[model samples]
Target: MFLNRKVELSLLENLHAEGKPKLILLYGKRRVGKTELLNEFARRHRALYLVARQEAYEGQLKKMSSEIAEFFDDDVLRHSPFQNYDALFIYLAQKETPVLFDEFPYLVEANRDLPSILQEYWDRYFSKKKTFLVLCGSSIAMMESLLGYKSPLYGRRTEQILLEPLKFREACEFFPQLEQEDKVLAYAVLGGTPAYLLEFDYGKPLLENIRDRILQKNTFLYQDTMFVLQQELTEPRVYYSIINSIAKGNTRLGEIMNDTGLEKSKITKYLSVLKDLHIIERRVPVTEKSPESSKKGIYLLKDNYFKFWFRFVFENAEYIEQGRQEKLIGDKISPVLNNFAGFAYEEIVLEYLKSSPGFPDYIFGRWWDKEEEIDVVGLDSSQNRIIFGEVKWKALTEKEARQTLNQLVEKSVEVKWGENLKSGEIQEGPEKKYMLVGKKVGGKKRLLGDGYLVLELDDLVEN
Candidate 1:
């Protein structure tokens, strides 16, 4: 299931090759494969790895003491826990080795003063040494708080790595036989989680994989979200209700609170946790310079599988558990698939547009406070530039696409790219930018005399 982790792999490798004393912090969501990556890295380096267990502070320290004894050929260090970690610090200072602490937050939780202690050791002992100390965790709140300003470890960390899910392009490596359209569909369903992607059977059809590996009775991921919730927080049901509400399109703050029977004030904390977990994202239209200035903040479950499950399957869990997945997919989910795919297609297009060349610096999302919403908008603050784009999953012929382009020309006047453009002269503001993204590209006529850009999934898969 290992696909492309090019960016992360390269960074870690370069850090090691720098031949300096570096402290690396790796943090991300649970089951996003932080440990797996660390293990792979450690194996390559022949490093000493110690995973802090869920035991008392003294017991865990004693376990580490034993490992250090075995690693360094010092039998005396095994009998007792390194008193206050200063002794262990002194031992590690003499060696130029890679030392990793996985699930480090457990050690921190077992002893709140651990970060302060590490800070003292780093400044007094380890900072001048040549060892690479990597602290890894899944709790974003804990990790960020510890390394953030005002925390004990602030300014002491040399580097931080926040691992994300596999991208759409990387997911293609998992199922080579799967077509580009199917890769996009898989990305929508799996949302790039390596754990979820590993469950797929490359030899079988996508729907068959979904039926057996995802919806079956004893599937690992059937209660996956529940386990994640229980491990991370105490009040799982309330958070579940709010997440389910958002998944069902109850996006507004008031709407989510009402649907979940939670107070408005409490909703913020819950939503913040979800955002930190990278399961959901809150977005305001791009017109506003910052989130605070915008009143249009909308929350969405960013995890595609969770969104799909909450939207259709969770509502009919009884039937799903009774082996009605096929019927449910036909009766309830199929119609919504196109609609859902349409939204996902829009997201994919927006994401690509952001990273694509020729985009402006002040790129913002567009919504007209009505049904007219542009999928992506690139705004050039320096040059008063406006680019409009549309993403279509359907097979659009050149004529149909040209009509859509003409429609965009009409909609272009409504968007305020800046004050420089007069009513009839918005096109004169800057070179007009228009894009059409889909499974297949229509001819140049769809460009509407603007700088043309066409993106087809076929081209994406080859790269």
Candidate 2:
């Protein structure tokens, strides 16, 4: 199930190789595989890894103390347990073995002074030893706050990793037998989250898998989104309304207000929190100079599974409860599935370009100016190169591709990038590159022969 985290594993190994008392902070939203990554690394290096639970402070000490005692083979401590976290940390600091606390926030929750105690012990003891103390968490907000200026653990971290969901190619590893199109659709449903991706039975038909995994009540996959929201926010219901509004196609702030009936100021605050949690995002035209201040900014559920769940599963909950998933698929899910996959496909293309930059294109995102919109846009202003792309989820014949590119080229005129490069001697517009990506692009060779950028789903898979 551990697909592709060689980069992260390598990073951890390099830190260990440094042979210092390193403090590391590893975090991501729940179900994104923070604990799994730790487990894998711990297995290889024989690091002492402990998972904290939501319990009283004394109970927390007893559980972790037993694990530590068992790890160190100390019969005295095994029976008595450490009196408190301070004693436990002091004892552990005696050894140079790496110590990892998964769900570190749970420890902090049980004892607010835990971070300060960690700071004290790390400075007083662990610093002298090669004890690589790693703190990991699923709560994005709290984990991030550990490094903030006000926190006791600030400036103590020798390394930090914000573990994210798998990218398209890494996620593709989960479904080897499925076709590329089905793979894309599956990604759209489960997203890049490792835990969510594991829930899908790709061996079964895609729809059946979705029915059993997502629509079935009490299933882990079905309840995970709620779990994420509930874990991250104190007010999950209000955030749910805002996310639902965006999910229902109210991208504009005003539109969301109209749909949710929440005040603009309140929605803005919630949106900021969601954005911080990585559950939602605000986007503006890629060409905009100051995206933060851009009035044209629109809101979207950035997480694929969140987008799909709110738009489909949650909306059709009654039918799902009634176990009419077959009818639900026919009437609600299948017809719109292609369009839904199109967004994920576009994201894949953007990620591919960024990861394997074919050109010097630095800035990348979707672009929109009035009625003109490009699915993916890449800007390399230094070289005066601008790449405009259109992504379609369905197959396209050569003629269809040509027509789409032609329309894309026409739209490119409105997007102005290199205005400063304008001079009397150099009297041409920015260098434009046109790209078209789809599930199966027909006559791709012919299109490439004509000097147009063409990509197919299979072509991306090979990479």
For residues 1-463, write the lDDT of model 1, one tens digit per residue. 3457778877888888887778889998877878888888788897888898888988887888988888877867766558767777777877888989999999988988889888988888778867689999988778888777998889989999999876666766776787667777777777767888788786786667666777765787676867776777778888888888988889889899888888877998989888877778988766555667667788988777788767765677876768898887777766677677777767776766566554537475655434567676666667755677777887677878778777877776666435534324654567667767777766754464556667776655563
Q: 105-167 in candidate 2: lDDT tens per residue?
A: 998998999999889988898877888989999988999999899999889888889998888
The 0-to-1 C-alpha lDDT of every candidate, in the order given, reads 0.76, 0.85
TM-score of 2: 0.96
Poorly placed runs, candidate 2 (over 4 Å) = 420-426
- Give the Å error, residue 293, model 2: 1.4
Error of 1 at 85 (Å): 2.5
Worst 10-residue lDDT window for candidate 1 reads 415-424
Residue 249 in model 1: shift from native, Å?
Answer: 2.1
Query: How big is the positional error of residue 229 in model 2, measured in Å on the Cα after superposition?
Result: 1.0
